[model samples]
Target chain A: MEAPERLGEVVQASTDRFTAQCYRLYGAPPLGSLVRAGEREPHVYGIVSSVTTSSLDPTRPVVARGASEPTEEAIYRSNPQLERLLRTDFEAMTVGHTQDGTIHQYLAPLPPHIHAFVFRCTPDEVRAFTQRLDFLPLLVGARTPPGDEVLAACLREAASAHDQPTEFLVQAGRKLALLLGGEMQRLNTILRRLPL
Target chain B: MTGREESPEVLGPQLLGVVVGGSLSQGLEVRLEDGGVVEELKVGTFVTIRGERHRFFGMVTDLGLASADPRLPSALPDTTNPAIVRILSGTSAYATMQVTPSLVVGGEETSLLLEGPQPARSIPFHFSRAYRASQEDVQAVFGAEDERHIWIGSPLDMEDTRVCLDLAEFVKRSNGVFGKSGTGKSFLTRILLAGILQRDVAVNLVFDMHSEYGWEGGSEEGHAVKGLKQLFGSRVAVFSLDEESSRRRGLSPDYLVRIGYDQIEPQDIETLAEMLNLTQNAAQATYKLASRHGQQWLREFLALEGREELAALADQLGEHQQTIESLRRRLDRLNRMAFLVERSPEDSVRRILEYLDRGTHVVLEFGRYGSDLSAYLLVANLLTRRIHDSYVRRKEQSLGDRAKEPRPLVITIEEAHRFLNPQVAGLTIFGTIAREMRKYNVTLLVVDQRPSGIDEEVLSQVGTRITCLLDNERDIEAVLTGASGARELRQVLARLEPKQQALIFGHALPMPVVVRTREYGPRTYAEFGFREQAELAREAEKDLKDLFG
Candidate 1:
């Protein structure tokens, strides 16, 4: 397949998978349902698992999985294919079982891709994701563009998860968000200038 | 025209020339329409033509007239006089003459050039002459007529002008009058005194050496003697070299103690010892003894000692024995010359102590006693001691009050060179006075004809100096060294005439000025109008001869 065709297919499958996982874990529709209803824009709800892969590799896929619910441990077991993919690609992993009996797991390969995704998520969306999940996955390596956005979202979620309102956590969250945004911008610039 | 020999005497107003060969020569002589020939054409002389004045002052380098009508008269004026026309064409008119003409006559009327008087080569004394100073020049040199400080003499504009110092600044630093004998130094000195005493603020203390000022106040011929006495009152005290008076008030042993002999070096004490025939050890012992037990101790020590012991102590001085002996001899001479009775050393010292306690300007008349160096030294030391005591007492008071009230005292030493010899070991009095006196408001006004004879160190420390007609080059150089603005002072000193001309240079004078001295007041001296005792015998013989005849 041509590179653009493959990239488009990957993006579509990731969006669908994230939507399904988010709905299963939260007992609610995907964040995109809100965008469809004109309440907000499409946003991801996931945990940062592992980050690996080069930002310059066009063939290398940027992957992440939605967090799981605590009550849905059986569901994670049923999704053997997804779990296997997460285990192979992710440098780290996190599983979440929500109170609604829905299981979810998140996996990210290519730190740049995770950073890009976190950079794109708003603070409110990150906060909402953190409220639905118990454990958050820590990003292990650098990523670019949508991966950076994903990392920023995860950091903001982690900060919101703290019991106490700490200046250090808030400041850290802000710095991580800025770093992710800068990385995404650098990756986008590089990609745009490519001869292809 | 007188004759045709002189080329027809240059007739008519126009000269008609004819072309001959390749040149145009005179064709015909044109006559004036008035039927007259032009006579003389002087350049500066005025001429009337057509009822308008025209000056004939330039040469006719070229003359021609162009006219369409041949009938018009072509006669030109004659130009011959050398004064009138410049043959060379570049000669300028005399500056006295006013007329200057341009070559192109453009119908402009020439100004009426009147000749002005020529400038004189030299200015004369009178205002009518060119040499006279203008009113502005007079004001610039002499200042305004109403100026208070400057005094304008009669014939004030002349170079013989005299400028009296403003008394205000003059009195701040006292003036000095000095000159060689027969130089009228004394005459000028008296004149300065007269002028100074006229001021309300003037206070003078004159050291009368020749008794000239003394006779002025009594039955004497000098004027203003009574006025001076009234001015100073009891402040002035005159000490004559009359045997009794000199002996009574001369420098005594107690005076040295009172003046603080503790400050005097052992050399001086040794000299004093030799003068009194005391042993070297005795002199040193006496000095130390005096320092501890005061003047009374010296008297007691001398009374208990034998003459042989004193002589042995003087011998023990060894190398300094001569100096010590000379000093002892000087002290002995002081006792005799001053006419003070030879008393015990203690009694003499006590007298000095008493005199110093009373602050009086003591003028010691050394003339009667003759020129005795020891007498001069003794008197000087006595006066110095008195002055030192007063200064120390006042200084102590001032210091006690944290320097609240300062008493300024000045000691004017006449014939200062005699006492301020650099060779003398104990002559530190002068150096001490120069360096330390200012702190106690005590100043030394040293008057001497030869400033070079004094110690250079002491001379250098003199903040103010009044230089009279110093004839010696060394003296002049010495004065110059102590003087501020030395270059100007040297110039003034070089031009100073004998007597009246003196270059007063120092902090006291604004600028060195040559000044004439003022006359002394009659009251400055006590025995006024008395002839000298030497002249009295001669006068008596002349009187007896006249009576017998």
Candidate 2:
């Protein structure tokens, strides 16, 4: 397997989630992509739940300068300082963690440390983590807006990592059915997003 | 996934479900596996539950659908989507069934093979896996066909496996074959009769009301089906009450039974009171005349020529003239019966006894008189009373010598309610035989459609009941009156097909089983040593040529 692609560094952390700053101004991973943050063993795994790009300083508000430029690239070329001033960060909800090379589909005892390198998991890692689908209920129970969409996106991404992606999604859908049995409307909304 | 647990390993390919709840009396509840299609599980199919240490045999009595959440039904999610249907079927919503455990085979494997199955007194533990009963399991429960056991048919949905009845035990007590008219009661009765005759378990004296058991009876498709006489040849003797009707049907019976008027006792008249619609005064007047005129009462009474002579005789016997007139009116119905004669040259009862003594089964076809219940009631009552008396005498004399005991006799009667109903059950000889005949070496094989009309006591005493489709609620209740797990068996009995299938339970079977009754055709005939009609005709032709030569 190829080396895991480096994505960001964790800048903020909590028991269930962490915020990571990307290497470039707009280098955040796509929503629902799985990422691990750690330099050694016991890497905390999470799914990208949200993303944002803003000035590094909370009090600073940068003004638009592209009105007179022929395209957006010209404004960037004229203002090279803008890339250094702005930062891209993504929030990931912790779904599980790896311990002694075994992926446990549950919360890690401790959150990722500040500035821990975050890496986009390889297809093999996603396949290994989604093998059991025991972590589905955690995504379903996540306290976030568009939780259903994030869960569906995560499943779609995991499905692509398996030999029989449709079969894997069907199995995951069955687990979600048990989790959301009483909420048929919600379950239907999530299942409709799953690709054939 | 928060509370998920590993699924148990299914022990066999036929694994159906796992036991969840229930009791020994109410049956067990099983939640079907996710891979199982609820449509494939049918009620009345046999199942085996593998418990911690025992294997419990059961039948699927009921099936239903359940949802994990109560609001699923009202929400009514779109079921047209395949994904939604697939996910919700076994997890969010699932199928459950009720299994009534009937028999239990316990102990080590070797001991279980030796001891066989016993009645289940306990329920399987929770989560015990249940599977469709394999052929070997069913074979172990219902023993293989042999001399003492007769293969009746296969259990429901198991065409290759067999369900045998222990005929040796079946003949020890009176049994019943019940179904509504045209439900193939006659065909099932024929099968049982053939089995009994083939095994020589007991000697049968069938009062064939429709002449269906003597010569050849018509099947539901209007084709000729062989009767006992045709199947067993010399081993079975056909007696006819209407010689003309028998000859018209191309049957030359071995004997033509004629009941002499002098042989008609007061009890016979009393037994016919219901069929003849005789009043209480008329019924009593028969005893009065019998006491006065002795054994020739019926003959002398029918000989009375005028109203004045009857009045004088009524006055002589100290009976009311109106009562005597009523008795004369009802007794006149018997005079129209052709089988009744002024004096029969030979005793039909002795002739039957002779045939029975020779170990030959006898079927007395009622012929044209079968439709007349009065004639049937009179003759059946009269002959059975004498037979019962003779059996009692012989059985009493053979007390210390078991070998001298008369061969067990199974007297088969159709429209059994007429002779064994509650009103006349205590008064009729058939009722006596059904109640306490085991000691006297006599039992009854009752064939009837309206079982509710039979005496409840007699119905309870029916050791084994092989019942076909019965639509009436009362009839169904009557057949399953005293059965254990009757509520479960009721569903099985009611759902039986209108033809060929029957639910047999009681002494003959260890547990209640629904059977697709064996086909009564050329194969069965050949099994019982019956030659084909064309072959028999050729043999007869050869016999004629030899005699002439």
Top candidate on lDDT is 2
Over the full model, what C-alpha lDDT does candidate 1 score relative to the true structure? 0.36
Provide per-model DockQ scores: 0.00, 0.40
Interface RMSD of each: 58.2, 3.8
Best by DockQ: 2
Stretches of candidate 2 off by over 4 Å are A61-78, A143-145, B1-12, B34-36, B106-111, B314-320, B532-549
Task: Return the lDDT, model 2, position B50.
Answer: 88
The residue-by-residue lDDT of candidate 1 on A48-166, one tens digit each, is 33333222234645443335534566555756554333311122122222223332323322112222222222444334444432232233233433444544344444454445424
lDDT of 2: 0.88
**Residues B1-549 of candidate 2: C-alpha lDDT, one tens digit per residue:** 222353545564477889999998889999887635578877789999989988899899988888877777776656887766776778788899899999986544565677789888778899998988888889989999899898888988799999999999999999999999888889888888999998998999999989988889998889988888878889999999999998898779999999899898888888888877788878888888888898889999988988999999989988888888888888888889988998989999999999998999999999889999988888888899999899999999899887779999999998999999998998899999999959899999999999999999999999999999999999999999899999999888888998989899999999999999888876678875688889989999999999996
lDDT of 2 at B32: 87
Write the residue-wise lDDT of candidate 1 on B404-508 in tens digits: 433344455556665565654244355577656366555565666767767776677665455556778777787787554353345456545664445544443
Write out the backbone clash pairs for model 2: none
Error of 1 at B520 (Å): 4.6
Q: Among the candidates, what TM-score does chain A have in each?
A: 0.24, 0.96
> Model 1 chain B — which ten-residue stretch has the worst lDDT?
B88-97
